[model samples]
Target: MTDPQIERKLIEIMRIINESDRPVGARIIADELRNRGYNLGERAVRYHLRILDERGFTEKHGYTGRSITLKGKEELEEALIGDRLDFVITRIEDLIYRTDYDPVKKQGNVIVNVSYVDKDDFEKTAGLMRSAIDYSISPRVGIFEEDSEDIFVPTGKVGIATVCSITFDGILLRHGIPVKPNFGGILSVENNEPVVFKDLISYRGTSIDPIKIFLMRQSTSVTGLLQSGFGTILANMRSIPQSAVENASLLFQQLHESDIGGLLAMDNESGNVLGAPVDVGMSGIVVSVGVNALAVVEEYGIDVTTRPVSTIMDYGTMKPL
Candidate 1:
């Protein structure tokens, strides 16, 4: 087996090359690594690059430097799996910290979930998306047909950006209400009402977003909910300090008036929200997930790959679905 330290250094080298828009030289890679707190010199970086080349993880570009190979990306993902464990919670916290969106001003950066779909299915997808939006955490969204510096649209596909429900958590946190994201799950619905979670995956226990797993398994019945008012949709559970319940409730009202409404239920007395228990001082709350719109499209036999908590975009740029 390779020395763990050396292996990490190689991975970091590939990561730097992979993220670069063009091939990167050893000096550039070395400087980037040092910036990341890795103390590899240009000479040491060249040696590591040779190992990556030998392993078919990188390819040389006529001395212009080196670019990561397809194998490099695969290897990088696999090598980082251990580090990715329990990453969802960290991502949530990061997005929350980055969110500076103001409901009253309706301006600032908010988190969004990006979904890639087949271009041929765009028309039908839009219709289904509107239906799903009615059941989603937010009614606003952004669509992209062409790739840009910030948005990557694959060939023969379109990209849709939906408001993530976590925006609510960020809003609450910014307002002095401590928000604790608990889990993402398939929420059961009857007569268009959220009942309970059919399955739960804690954010702190998963490598990827739980909603992505549920969607991949086709576990949600968002289409069913749209057609018959009975099925399952994506939802998330969170908690807040009991003392902040009133303030949080008021904030939610302001959000709703601003056209951002997805509060399913808030429970403090029962210490539970839709069967998920809350701690003694925390109040449980459930909100409709933003990805439910994409789930509906998926249920209709349309293919979609979702990137939850994908990126932050200015709220003013988004338009209603």
Candidate 2:
């Protein structure tokens, strides 16, 4: 068995490599370790990498350095399972704290969901995406060509970064209004209108984002909704203090004026929004899911991989799609 301290250092090294856009060398790994308060130098880092390579946890490129292998990812997940409880909610809070987008000024960084699509299918994907944009969290998107550093775009695939609905939560939090993300669910639509939630997975109880679950199950019909005005679409439910409801409404309006509208409904009283209940002191709010378009592309038989609530990016850099 590995020493507990050494095991922790290994996990951190693998995590850093896993999150990198490209293969990382010992120098970069050592620098990252130092930033995280690890005192290991490049030589020590290389020793650890050799151990990882021997264990088949990582693979090395000629001179590009190392990348985590499939086994490595699985091992990391298994080792960190205990620490990932309520991780989705924790990540939301972190992203909210990091979000600094100013809608009034129309600048700053906002949380985004990144998706990768084959370059050949990008045009069709974009058209399909446009069909579902009005139903998406935001109408703006950032496109990254292959080999771009802004975000990982696998070779031959383009990356699309869509504005996440959580940006609303972040903006509200920045203005002193606490927002509580409750669940991700499917909203039934009829005649171009939202009816009720068909399913919900609470963020606090799940390790993974519920939206990703729904997407994986191909549970959304956003394209169907666009074509026939009757289908189930992905959405999220949140709660906020009733006293902050009024202020939240103003902020949401400003968000719309700035062209980031995703607000589907907000309850006036401590009741419910679109049939999802809220606590006594809280008000229910619902918004469209940001990756709804990606689901549509998937439904159309175009393969796409998504990283929901992935990271933050400059809002001004995104373009209308």
Candidate 3:
């Protein structure tokens, strides 16, 4: 097998190339890595670049710069999955075993976000979500569609689903919220609504290996949303008012500076940006794990001082997604 050190560097190289609008050179990428605490130089970076090119994860432009290929993006995402495995796995445990679940008054939820390049990929992901949801045996789950009001979603686009876990479906860590019972959904303001994974799936579909999904909500007990799922995690910023959410520089900055290693920081492209400054108004509805949640709350000045869970809605006959 390739040296683990070199393999990591290769992933970082692809990350830089994927985030850059312009072609990137090894020296530029190497320097970037050094700033992030990776110890390497241009020569070493270039040596690996050639290997990546040979592996078809990237392409070279002689003196111009390097660019990532479709394969490269997939590899990067897969690597990210590895990086988040511990956090995800841990949260999954926390949700299932660490918390109390009441069927009559279920108030937990998990939001699933999926990124796809084509119709075929979209369908497979949707089917996977369906299978995962069924697997979870969540009592109630609402797959959010495009909001009729233009304010919540684009006029013409695939509506995203905000799968709510009202019944302690799973456990997740909200970055800025306290580590108690809490609620909030993190989503993009511009995008407004989730991109529904199922609708985009044309009937001629295949299957995808299961992926862990998580969600957070602002209210401690979201009356109707319910859940049941595979290994997953969640985070929420419910206390941050709608006003402060607009100027999320510090919220995202705090996230970047946070030591908790929550959700992956998003990059400038589509879907998730793990370990970078998340976009402003990138909203999520997550319940706090109560551990790392306080660090963000104090820094951002959110007022969810206590877990305000009360008034469980009578969950009567809600269909599952």
User: Which is the better candidate, 1 or 2, if ranked by lDDT?
Assistant: 2
Estimate, for each residue in 1-321, the C-alpha lDDT of model 2 and write its tens digit.
889668767988999999997899998788666434355778999999999999999999989999999999999989857756755787678778889988788789888988889899999999999988888877889999865645656689898999888888899889998888898999999998899999988888787789889999989888788889999999999999989889989888888877888788888777677878888989888999889888899999999988778878889899898
Compare candidates 1 and 2 on TM-score and give the better one.
2
TM-score of each: 0.79, 0.81, 0.29
The best candidate by TM-score is 2
For residues 151-198, could you state the per-residue lDDT of candidate 3 as single tens digits? 122223232222223223222223232222122223221121222111
TM-score of 1: 0.79
Deviation in Å, model 3, residue 216 alpha carbon: 19
Ranking of all predicted structures according to lDDT, beginning with the best and ending with the worst: 2, 1, 3
1-321, model 1: which lDDT tens digit per residue? 699668867877888999999999997787556434355678999999999999999999998999999998999989857756755676578678778888788778878888889999999998998877877877778888755334667688888888888988888889988898998888899998889988998888777788888888889987778889999988898899888999999988888866788889898664678977778888888988888899888888988988887767787888887
Worst window of 10 by summed lDDT in candidate 2: 31-40
Model 1: worst 10 consecutive residues (lDDT sum):
31-40
Clashing pairs in 1: none
Tell me the spans in candidate 1 whose CA falls farther than 4 Å from its real position.
1-83
